[model samples]
Target: MRDASAVITKKLYEEDAYRTEFDAVLVSVRRKEDSVLDVVLDQTCFFPEEGGQCPDRGELGGLSVLDVQIEGNEIHHYLEAPKDALPEAGAGIHGKIDWPFRFSNMQQHSGEHLFSGTVHRRYGFENVGFHLSPSEVTLDFDGVIPEQDIPELEREVNAAIWSNIPSVVRMTQREDREGLTYRSKIDLEGEVRIVTFPGIDSCACCAPHVARTGEIGICKVVSMIRWKGGVRVSILCGKRALEHFQKLHGIVVQTANDLSTSMENIFPQVVKLKNERQQLLARLKDASLKELQYAAKEIASDEEHALLFSSGAELPAVRKVVNALCAEHPGYCGVFVGNDEEGYSFVIGSRQLDCAGLGRQLQETLGSKGGGRPEMIQGSVARKREEIEGAIFSLTRP
Candidate 1:
């Protein structure tokens, strides 16, 4: 019921301006079935999600642009339709972005380059991976870096920031860049946009970047893990770095208050508390085992079979008690307990009796599942405790 032939113009480089209001003529419009109006401007400043950096978000003429994508050379702006009717094709429209969000992304992305470049330059480590997300930017390096060297690397990157080096964006012909030095993990064979972090890093990229290295503000390494024959470094930059510090400071304060200790001594206090709790739990487990042993003596049946059912004992404790009881008695001893979210678990064993046949019969009768050696079997069932008991009795009574 709507026209499909509108024209729009796209402005390719709006990120260069820290803040700008722009106007463009509608180049074309295509309506998808989901009610999203795919409108294209002859030119646009909205950067599409490309080269790992997410797209810029903003509004066009008061309509929310939910997503932006590049198909071929045209940048498609997906926006919600007005209640009355869609905007006509060929109409001029204004576009703007949330500058703060865009600026934060620029800071984090540029900071990642400096970090990666410094690591590579100092240790001969290759950057094997990179991810730029809304929350943080992460880089993976090819080898383990010593803990003592991390501070030095951070200092090196911040030193570049202090230098106020110009972040150059250059377009060079493929042949003209023959001897130029840059870090490229993949082969690039065409005309490319090179982003250079002055003396720190130079790489071919198409994403929008800040004007100067100092604009990156700061870079912080949060964690490092060995991965894929290499080390993965998790990092936060600029605003995110500041946010991480504030969050950790708040936690330290809250922990200190809860433990009735000063912030300066919280670390040692927490370590002491953890050690004390572990010792107490170990003693409790030993006491529980003694009680279970005494309980087993009273419940041991004179008949050939003994059955024990408990509701809340942990799985490991139940298993320990069941195995000990079966070893002491020659007849069948089965233990049943409720598992966390997993309905019920049964452990059955016998010293002289064949438990494998009984275990299979129980599984088939109760519609349950599990298996073990010829002398013992353990598994879970979906039925209630009463239903499981009824099924087990039916299988074992004969």
Candidate 2:
């Protein structure tokens, strides 16, 4: 609304954000590519991508508007079309904004303001960064937030939403502002657009937001990760939050039913299953190691090298057998576990030959991956067992 006479495109979005359609005349048109057109409108309801909020997408003159961007005073609307079908400059056109997309973005953006404002007031932390995508929204803060206070922060955020506070927007002159406190990432010049959430936040922004906090439905902080010198918090708001909860609930219900227990007992049951699996794996590994060691003693090792293969054995068990064989045979010892189609987990050792060089040789020739010391090496290869055995036996040839 700041001196519409000075700007070319009349941004109808600034007047009424809820307005989804508008009639506008084309100010200019240029064909950017064979099927792509850049059309500027005299007035538009589609909001351009600004202030970290994504562009509003919809149809303009029956052509799909892929993106909307601001270049100085003009809002460039990127459209798809054939050259013959494009509207000429000065021609009137209909502009439609996708309401659902706009509403979802508004919910998340406004929800973030509420949360950021509350955290800033309570913890003295600044919101340094924000990103909103279709799948996730993340806010980066300038200071660490205590983990114990997160629940309290969530409670406060939900409380502010439940209060159904109205968000106010004002355009102020740059010089008229004095001794006024606000959150801004940069020092904006000219006319400044200030968005205020009463008793919660006042920040400079150029994006459309929900008129009331209650429209955001619910705001849930999903994750927090240590970032730079501060913390990054991930959140889901409105419909996204509801969908996330439902998906998780479905998984919990399925798991509880499968275990023949209630949801409350799912955690203990999963932990018990995990512990049982670990104990079984340990016993199986011990038996495999003993069996491999006994088989290594039984092999006729008059030659300088020996190789053995086991089915479905772990890498650790293979390494144990290789170490024992190398201690006894003194030349080259190799153990391969798993079938040829799935590749083999291999361990090679030698007190005499260089196992690292052999591993490298196999890697270069057979496209295998792994490495270790000269005396002992571990890796995997997709080559057939016969090919690997032939290569090992060739080293023992007279």
Candidate 3:
């Protein structure tokens, strides 16, 4: 028998992706101070996180394998359940991987390959990056892609998926890797694993993928964002795509019923509501400006300080009122909006005193927060109205 420490766990996942469970002998168990056990198995179907794919999680002998890692060509399973007696070295254990999670990853990964290959061939752009999760896959391209071309690209991807092309994995020796071009993010030195989709693409990857394009079911480009002078596209494949579409459809139906409109007319109704809102806001701003001007004139005297409080008022209107008062008197003019517990939105200005200095002094006195230019300052303060007014009146004494 090979030395326990010298044992290399067979990677059953690499050979047969459908293999969900395996019986393996424990080679060694290293006990830690924290009571967790790191066990080395003679064989495992669990895939460790590598090459941008998340690691597989499952059960080992009724205990959870919280994590699996690769160290020095040996796969170590990090087992939890500290209170349970640790399995001895050379003991047999049954390992079962979460099949649904593994299959979801496989579908998204394989779907990305097909879609990225389509993009590369159609536009001559390189797939700069790829990320696969259980819910979605994102592909980053090295160059800009025209927005007009996205719909056609999506069509091409779905066509390939419907074709049910075989995804073949071939292993080749280092010296014989000539004339076999494939897309790879890193340089390879040892035996290379090539994943090829007939009439689509070939790339070097170690992650387990679905055996056929049709297994991806459907592919949807849900979103695209400009990233690092390129483009990042979010995709949903297979059941993920179905679930996403169903959720969005539900939202649309709810919106249509709420608006009392048909699904096709939801867009026009939303636009109408937005336009009406803009008109109402314009009228309200006009009325608020008039009201503020009237309130400013009602101050009665060119006093050293004038303080006003209004509820649910616009900050811009408050600033205008303060400006009008500042134009008339060389005193501190301020406005406070909102309530005591939540703090007040304040705008203060002065021609006689340095507004910035006054703001700093108030912040120091009340331990508040805010700042400004020499003539004007604006911020929110947690202090109450009476306390704030008293501080300002004291600072602006003639």
Clashing residue pairs in all predictions, respectively, total 18, 0, 0
TM-scores for all candidates? 0.76, 0.86, 0.83
Give the C-alpha miss distance for residue 251 in model 1, angstroms. Answer: 3.6
Residue 238's lDDT in candidate 1: 79
For residues 1-398, write the lDDT of model 2, one tens digit per residue: 13322458878887777899899988788888989998887889988988777799899989999889998888989999886876777788998988998898899999999999998999889999998876789999999998888899999999999999999988888875667678888877888888899999998888888899999989999999999999999988998899899999999999999999999999999999999999998887777777777789888777567788877567767877888788778778998887888878888899998989888888877788999999999888998998888776774566
Which of the two, 1 or 3, has more TM-score?
3
lDDT of each: 0.77, 0.86, 0.84
Residue 198 error for model 3, in Å? Answer: 2.1
Off by over 4 Å in 3: 1-5, 32-35, 134-136, 175-177, 226-230, 297-305, 312-320, 323-332, 338-343, 349-361, 364-367, 371-378, 383-398
Best by lDDT: 2
lDDT tens per residue, model 1, 60-104? 878877788877667888887654547766898899876787888
lDDT of 3 by residue, 133-194 (tens): 55557899988888888888889999999999988998878876788878888778888888
- Model 1, TM vs. native: 0.76
For model 1, the stretches where C-alpha displacement exceeds 4 angstroms are 1-15, 82-85, 124-129, 140-147, 170-180, 184-192, 226-231, 262-274, 300-305, 309-332, 336-346, 349-369, 372-376, 380-398
By the lDDT metric, which is better: model 1 or model 3? Answer: 3
TM-score computed on alpha carbons, candidate 2: 0.86
lDDT of 1 at 153: 83
User: Could you report the Cα RMSD, in angstroms, for every candidate shown?
Assistant: 4.8, 3.7, 3.6
